[model samples]
Target: MSGITENTKTSGEPSKENPSPNSSDTPDDEKKDDRMFECNICLDTAKDAVVSMCGHLFCWPCLHQWLETRPNRQVCPVCKASISKEKVVPLYGRGSTKQEDPREKVPPRPAGQRTEPEPGSAFPGFGFADNGFHMSFGIGAFPFGFFTSTFNFGEARPTPAARGTQQHMEEQFLSKIFLWMAILFVAWLLLA
Candidate 1:
């Protein structure tokens, strides 16, 4: 990737124009060396590159999207942090996410409002409040196990948002787990 000089006459930073070496429409072995590294997130030829705190470099969009709601995606593709929601360094290569700390930027924690854990969070075999195992299923696929103090297994219902969307499909997958539990429960009842 071309380094953006301290000078700013060109676009006040790096050139915004995409790289287009007019040497050839046909692939040239020599031009390959001139190719700028593309950012993984945006897939654009990078004029500068920024490394994530995880040491991963991606275009602004990819890293930003990853950071925006990273609870859904916990692992860093590069470093594999169990908790990657916290991006340490703002990569400066290409046009990655501008240097900004999520913690500082995160809105004030709501009063008495609990932050929900990711749908299925775990530490290998162990689990956390966000861990997916503490919860179980009913008839249909749905997520009953969330970080909540009030988890009632006696009833079968869906959360308002979990009522639909891809999450519902995941909950349905858990329904099979529920079905097996139901069978086991019935057998235990008869034995008793």
Candidate 2:
């Protein structure tokens, strides 16, 4: 009876000294590994890849379509960080040359945004003078005139207005006006 019990225990449990053939650590096993550079949206190897600020990788087409789908809320699909067409960085790789040209699509991948470095403190000529002020005004004919604006700033650029102030009230009014204009424009497009 004791011998029978011992035999059952040995059969039921695996031996520690000898590992199973199915173990993943075995170097002799040939398994196909999926590439790490897969698109978050399409689940395929990323082509014309772009990396989000949050560091998730995706194919540019997939990300662009996603952004177009929800133009109002442009956020990263993986991390939900605030992202926009201007924010994504395009990846250029040796293999990218072999991929199909991305320009054939309706909306091509967004161009990377580049800004010139700010003038250093030593370069005083480029900066605003102590009492010097700057203002710019442009008057485009008719329809484009609404888009144009005149900006005036003193020695220091004007800061944003605090809530509940007259300046804030004016800003809110202008925002609503623009919002209504945009809605009207869309409605006109649909009718046309």
Candidate 3:
């Protein structure tokens, strides 16, 4: 009985001489590992691969289509994390080349954009004349506000174009159209 129990224990436990079938060196394990690099959307190997900020992998074309389907609410398909074309990082495998693809619609993975830092200026206000720029902000009754702004009270406005010139005629025509629009708007407000 003791000898039979000992044999059963030895058979159950895998020995160096008889390797277990579930070892990582098997081809099945390798194929499963290849799946790990597959696109989350397509469930196949990634082409023009990109990785979201949340670390989910996707093929650029698949991800682009997903984003196009919902232009307003862009989020990661796998994790619902906020994502955008600008935010995803492209994964360039060692074998990938810089060759231009022929497909017009399916664009290649996005490349990182680079721009030079803006040159620092000694004086921040160098672009403006000290007294030339004036800005006023106020909230008042609509009619009073409109009159004050339209008449250009207490502000330097450019003089109207020279009388009888093409420019002057154009301005007058534009003003009349606007005056009609304002009157219609006021009428609508009163009626409503």
Candidate 4:
């Protein structure tokens, strides 16, 4: 049977239309290859594509063509690994689902939609400071800590605390520190 028919027979599930050791079809070859992740750069089903040391899959010729153009400084388009033409395999085989997909672990965020740090539910006045959403940085990457955490006192100029202003000059600096220190000392003694 042709590869087309074999593929159609097992659309969602993987199976051979007719099992035969001598059959020349995709099903028989399927066992040999399990990695079939598509290349993001070139659009093609690379069965024998050379797998870069970075674990990215690419067609041998296509990868070769890419590296050939820039021989001395060859880098895998997906993983940016320094690869040489001689090191690349002439062909690759389909990969298995059991094999890890780098894309999933390093899921590409849409432009600026990356994860940010938002305050947890336990936190009331502290969280990410953004226009919308509760603000949660994805996984471990968080930029915005709180949307209202910013101490902006105006809808216009964010900073109106002119250093030269009389109010600023009169601002109590030492008193605030003394008061807090005394409060801390008392609290500590009480707890002790």
Best by lDDT: 3
Over 26-130, each residue of candidate 1 has an lDDT whose tens digit, in order, gives: 566334423434555666653334445544545444555566666566665556764343443433323445645333334432245366555442333333333
List runs of model 4 lying over 4 Å from the truth.
Answer: 1-36, 89-192
In candidate 2, the residue pairs with backbone N, CA or C atoms under 3 Å apart (3 or more residues apart, or in different chains) clash, namely: none
TM-score of each: 0.30, 0.38, 0.43, 0.28
- In candidate 2, residue 130 scores what lDDT? 34
Candidate 2 displacement at residue 189 in angstroms? 39
Q: Any idea what lDDT model 2 has?
A: 0.60
lDDT of 2 by residue, 64-177 (tens): 889989987999998799997777766655534554544335385457667766544543433345332333333355355534443222223444477789987887777777
Superposition error at 178 for model 2 (Å): 30
User: Candidate 4, TM-score vs. the true structure?
Assistant: 0.28
Clashes of each: 12, 0, 0, 24
The predicted structure with the larger TM-score, 2 or 4, is 2
Better of 1 and 2 by TM-score: 2
Q: TM-score of model 2 relative to the true fold?
A: 0.38
Give each model's whole-structure lDDT.
0.45, 0.60, 0.64, 0.47
- Candidate 1 Cα deviation (angstroms), residue 26: 16
